[model samples]
Target: MSTATAASKTWIRTSASIRAYLQLMRPANIVTAWADILAGYSATGLVMSEQTWPPLLWLLLATTGLYAGGVVFNDVFDAELDAVERPERPIPSGQSSLKGAIGLGIALLGLGIGAAAQVSELSLGLAIVIAIAALLYDRFSKHHSLIGPINMGLCRGCNLLLGVSAVAEQTQMLWFLALIPLAYIGAITAISQGEVAGGQQRTGVIALLLLSMVTGALFGLSFLPSVQGWNLLPFTLLLIGLVFPPFLQAADTPNADMIRAAVKAGILALIVLDASLAAGFAGWPYGLVVLSLLPGSKGISRLFAMT
Candidate 1:
């Protein structure tokens, strides 16, 4: 073979390998994770101005690592199952190695904690908790129908808190808000259980109920002086429009494809949920910043799987 041709082949191989790792990270989901940090930071009533940008930047990087790590470990733990049920996945398909995935997961998780440590001890603590919760869900809790969703929810809840910890004092006052994402993610997790074999109608119903409660909580927050009630309405309605239809369809059909569709919509709609929260806490501009993430996430989702 000619030297030029060999180099071209090498480049192609490297690019393909990089794509595999990106796939493992679920780039679309990572984009949604950024919205969590943005919303959390916004909840503190802090401006994302030049002076405060450093901390916000740190928290965003922290979540990127945390989310990427969490999902990488998920694929690591599910390698055996994927080999049978999802053979197209990177590890199962030989695009990425299990040992490499483990190393990547650990490094990403460590990066998450370290980045948070740059912000404050409190942020570091929350990052560590998120990492632990993610690993627990991936390795053990995911096997249990009841505990699985809650465990997954815990990771997302703490993730939002990680953003709040940007201002140590604000976190103390706003800690309870984490429950919103917790409940929302819990519903998503519940619906995700049926991705392969199809979900139960009751499970879908329960998830829908949780979603409703989450919506109610977001709406109730609008009544607070810190939140702009009108600014929140558009994103809240967008969220409802994005998630409810798929979830309702899954609830009615309870089939594999519909369940997958519901799970995808829920995961992607996380940005919308966070945008609503940001708007409620900060203003429409900040909320729009959060909502802007949706397009990139959607574009990437077309290339890589969300669930």
Candidate 2:
């Protein structure tokens, strides 16, 4: 074989390997993490004008690392289950080795925590907490009936809070607001499981609705005078209004697809609300909101269409 051909083959193999790794990280699933961080930052209403790039970069890297850790470790813990439920998964299918997954998990955890440490001690602390929670959920909590989703939700909530707490002084209200996304995370977790189980329970649907409402309320509260302006009241009301119909529908039928659809719609509404909050706080007029929502809507639409 020619030297050039050999090099091309090598490159192709490398590229394919990297793609598998990325899949293991589950990039599509990290949208909720992004939304959580965006929501937390929006609540603060304090966008840095001069030194924004540094914090934003740190936040992105840390979040990506942490999320990667979660995915890798979850696969490691679920290897046996995946053999039965999802043999095509990375570990079960031999697309990625178990050792590779565990090593990657540790590396990503370190990178995430290190990146957050660069931002602040508080951020670093939160990163550690999140890492621990992810590990616990993957190893143990995931098997527990109610505790699994709750633990997963808290992990996501902390991931968002880590971003905000990294940039600004911590607030009590921020902790309270974190519960909103926690609820959404719980709902999503339940829905994903329901789909796998081939049915949905009314209790699960009710839990999801309560979580969605809390999430909307928290988003609205972030725009209050304490954070931004009372003018945001209209936007908050609109978000809550947009969020309710889907939940009501899902409440009756309680299917996996319906729950997923409701979550998608809720995410779209959040993207809009957060972008608006970011704009309101940053003194930009509508540009950020438009930019954020367009891609978000497209992504969510594609995700649900597949399901």
Candidate 3:
């Protein structure tokens, strides 16, 4: 082959490899992590002030690394299962090697821990814990009945807390509130597993939805007394309203359609939650929320179109 052709072939291979890594990480799912980070940051009420960017950037990096590590580790543990259930995944599909995935996961975990250490000792500890939880969930909890969802929820809740601890002076109450998303994650994970395992179970899906709503409501109520006025109410209502339709729909349908709808609802709930926090601090939460939703909405729209 000519030199130019060889170079072109090399470039194609490199591009394909990059795409495989991205898919393995599941960038679409990372949206939930980003939202949690933002919500945590906003809840701190620091993002509104002048001294925001440093801790914000650090926490962002740490969270990204943590998420990347979790994604890779999950794939590492699920290689065999994916071969049976999702043979087209990066590992089973032959686009990426298990060894390479494991190496990348370990590197990302190290990077995340290092980044968290720069922020605070507490955050560094939380990062390590989150990484361990991810691994434990993938390896042990995933096959269990309800333990899987609980593990997934707790993992996400920790990610949110990591962001909060990175910038906030106190995070006890906020950390508790962060567990609200855990309920959401747990519900979604359980419902998803149900869909894959067999057909569907309305009772389980409904129970999960109720758990999510209750969690969200509890978080909202906890913040309400601290928030002075009606400013927070609108955002809370928006979030609750946004979450309700999808939760109901998912329970009613309980299939792939429900899964997609649930994803959209989760994305919207994150936007509302973040915007509420921003508003509680800055009084202009709607604009920031809209900005956050634009890119996500476009992506989801494209995904729906393709589907």
Kindly indicate the candidate among 1 and 2 with the higher lDDT: 1
| lDDT per model vs. reference | 0.92, 0.66, 0.69
Tell me each candidate's RMSD, in Å, in order. Answer: 1.1, 3.9, 3.3
Measured by lDDT, the strongest candidate is 1
TM-score of each model, paired residue for residue: 0.98, 0.79, 0.85
Give the alpha carbon lDDT tens digit for every residue of 45-104 in model 1: 667556468898899999999999999999999999999999999999998999999999
Query: Quick one: best TM-score, which candidate?
Result: 1
Return the candidate ranking by TM-score, descending.
1, 3, 2
lDDT of 2: 0.66
Q: Predicted candidate 2: what Cα RMSD to the true structure? A: 3.9
Tens digit of per-residue lDDT, candidate 2, span 1-307: 9999999999987876676566678665555456556555654544545655676578767887898788788889889988997787767887778888889999998998898888777888888999999999989997766888799888977876875785555544557655766776676565555554444566556555665666456456554555544434455556567666766666667776766666666555655555444444443343254335547545645532322
lDDT of 2 at 126: 86
After aligning candidate 3 to the native by TM-score, how far in Å is the CA of 300 from where it should be? 7.8
lDDT of 2 at 192: 50
By TM-score, is 2 or 3 better? Answer: 3
Task: For residues 122-176, write the lDDT of model 3, one tens digit per residue.
Answer: 8888888888988898788977767887898888888878878865465766666
What's the ranking of the predictions by lDDT, best on top? 1, 3, 2
